[model samples]
Target: MYQLPFTTVVESATSNTKKLELVVHPSVSSKFKRYLDIVGSLVGLLVLAILFIPIAIAIKIDSPGPIFFTQQRYGLQGRPFRIRKFRSMVTDAERLKSLVSNEANGLIFKNKNDFRVTKIGRFLRSTSLDELPQFWNVLVGEMSLVGTRPPTADEVMHYNQRHWQRLNVKPGLTGEWQVNGRSRVKDFEQIVDLDLQYQKKWYPLYDILLIAKTFYVIFGRIGAC
Candidate 1:
């Protein structure tokens, strides 16, 4: 695995040694970036709060499940944490996952017309309103305002050393994979490349730019599905 910081900043796994070695990266301890995350998340939470009532009503009316969906996702250095989203699918979506064929290649999964998605869920997903609750994750420091998208445990389980490099930075609410083309990019390897690219170019300014770019991407609906 490449890295991400929380309890520890980063750890590198050498294929030859098969041992985890600690490697500190600048983004891990940048107080400036942390400050950005705090401020950004608070703002995001406020926005979510403002929109919660209506969104909740729509979700309840459209589906018979909880308003929010929380799933175990791997964070920086592959740590497990619950990533929250507005429920975008039927209650039994997880159980029925095997019935839906994955259109994406490699460790990740995706289906454009996933039958499980509720009508309101599609709107939430395309507009990214479904991800609002994750600001809490960013506020609490489990994620960043801008970083790689968090992956599920099963997806991480299948990661190779090259793919592990993406986790070197904390998962973000939006990032390279996100702004470039969310689920539109089907190949998992391309996603790894984007994540690594973010790691390479990361800085507080760059993070700010990505955060700014996210708004454009979302509103324009460039790559929601």
Candidate 2:
């Protein structure tokens, strides 16, 4: 296991003022995990390279917009990083969000039948192919192969101090929430609870198990879209 000295920055549980506390460094078990992230991302990128042309062509033909979507997401310790995804919605999707009613739980927005989604986008979401570009984030150390899901800037803004604990670790391409029933999970608190559970019990073998379960979820087509 590999460990890094870290400082925990949090607002006082009782006070409005922010505070910093240095906790004893925990064994990270991340050296091999980082190695796996590098190797996995490389292989993923190679597959992306092979699929890019066809996917790009499909996206362009289905809608008039960029092939990729980039958004700012909170990473480890609430650091901001750009996350990339294959575009699956209208070019004006974010702006149009205000016009539609949200069907998701907590601070997130989700609509299985969202009109903003293009025909190809539906398939992309169902297959999770839209997330393929995140392998680049993994390669760059902005993300992990398995960990907590990254929150959007808007999502983070709504979070309380307890919610910030999830940011202690690098966000992931897939995680407990995803495998446990991602699209099906309605409450944001449940998601937070699962992330906290992962943090408390983190180990290399645990990550491997989650990764295996993620494959089953993906191929089984459960809780997708």
Candidate 3:
């Protein structure tokens, strides 16, 4: 059993809305969760180390840029943190975002056939191998093994008060959104709804279930890419 942290209310000057931020303090279960994150992340990082060379070589052969993609993402309580992933797009992909047509609904961007994705990148994205580096984030406490997907600063800038609830807990490498429908889910509001639902019903067992489902989703390719 665990307790939902107290809520802290803050006024948003830009939107003139009150945002409820959950202030989670370390509890026994929370500490256990963190312990699991550390152990799991260590194992994950070992796997990443084994595959890093091959993936890096593939990226370099496919594109002329850094092998790792780093971006600022909102974490717990809307704090900014740098998130890392294997680069799966052309070097100029970010610059080209404005010119490309978005397939996703709401503030987030998604395009199944995005031209910016390199051949190797497409494969990596489909296999979710590009996200392997995020274990480091989990190991360092910037993320959890299971929680809401982190949002980009640009995406968070467009979020409504209710949408902000998702950031109450640490972001994750895989969560309800990843296991549910992923890119197939066109509506961003649905993703937020899932996040809020996860928050409301969070338990150690729930996290375990999500992690188990994630493996099936990935290996089965239910909604990959």
Candidate 4:
């Protein structure tokens, strides 16, 4: 793992007189984890390729916007990245955000009944198929198979110390929040706790377990979106 030069506050100023800039989670340097991400992302991309045509056609037929939605999101250590997903809402959804009521609390935002969702988008989210394009993010090494949920740029702006700690690991396609309650767990603080808990419980095998659980959660329709 490449360590950053001194850049943070006095909390990082140890006796060595060097400041620490970010959370240095052990998974960042795990060769095995990278190997798994490589193999899994390749396999996921293969699946995405097989399903892309149908999904794209469905989106085009059902909505006026582009097939994919791209947004700026905060990734590991507060870095910015363009996260992609199948477009599940109107193109002007961001502009209309204020009109929609946010049901979740804290820094995150959510509205289960958000009106911006199109008919086909509802199906995609319900089946979790809307997330397929993120396999590309994993292939490019911007994310992991199991890690914290990626936050929007706006969400990161409100983060304090504890919230920022969740950004230590790469974002994931499915994780603790995805499996635990996703929509059911509406509070951002609780999501932060879950992210930190995953860190404390992390290991290579633990990631595999989360992956398996992800399948169960998907099929069981435990937590959509």
**lDDT tens string, model 2, 34-151?**
8889998998899899999999999999999899999999777667799989999999998899888888778778777789999999999888889999999999988998888999
What is candidate 3's local distance difference test score? Answer: 0.83
Instruction: Give the whole-model CA lDDT for all candidates, comma-separated.
Output: 0.83, 0.82, 0.83, 0.83
Task: Name model 4 segments beyond 4 Å from true.
Answer: 1-20
TM-score of predicted structure 4: 0.90
Task: Look at candidate 3 and give me any clashing residue pairs.
Answer: none
Give the runs in model 1 whose Cα sits over 4 Å from its true position.
1-22
> If scored against the real structure, what TM-score would every candidate get?
0.90, 0.89, 0.90, 0.90
lDDT of 3 by residue, 1-225 (tens): 334555667775444545566565332248778888999899899999999999999999999999999999878877788988999999999889888898888978888888999999988988889989999999989999998889886787777667776877889888889989977887899999887777777776677888899999888888877
True-vs-predicted CA distance for residue 225, candidate 2, Å: 1.6
Model 4: weakest 10-residue lDDT segment is 11-20
lDDT of 4 by residue, 30-85 (tens): 99989999999999989999999999999999888799999887678766788889
Error of 1 at 90 (Å): 0.2
Total colliding residue pairs, candidate 1: 2
lDDT of 1: 0.83
The C-alpha RMSD of each candidate to the native structure, in angstroms, is: 4.5, 4.0, 2.7, 5.2
Query: After superposition on all CA atoms, how large is the RMSD of candidate 2?
Result: 4.0
CA deviation > 4 Å runs, candidate 2: 1-29
Model 2, residue 182: displacement in angstroms? 1.5
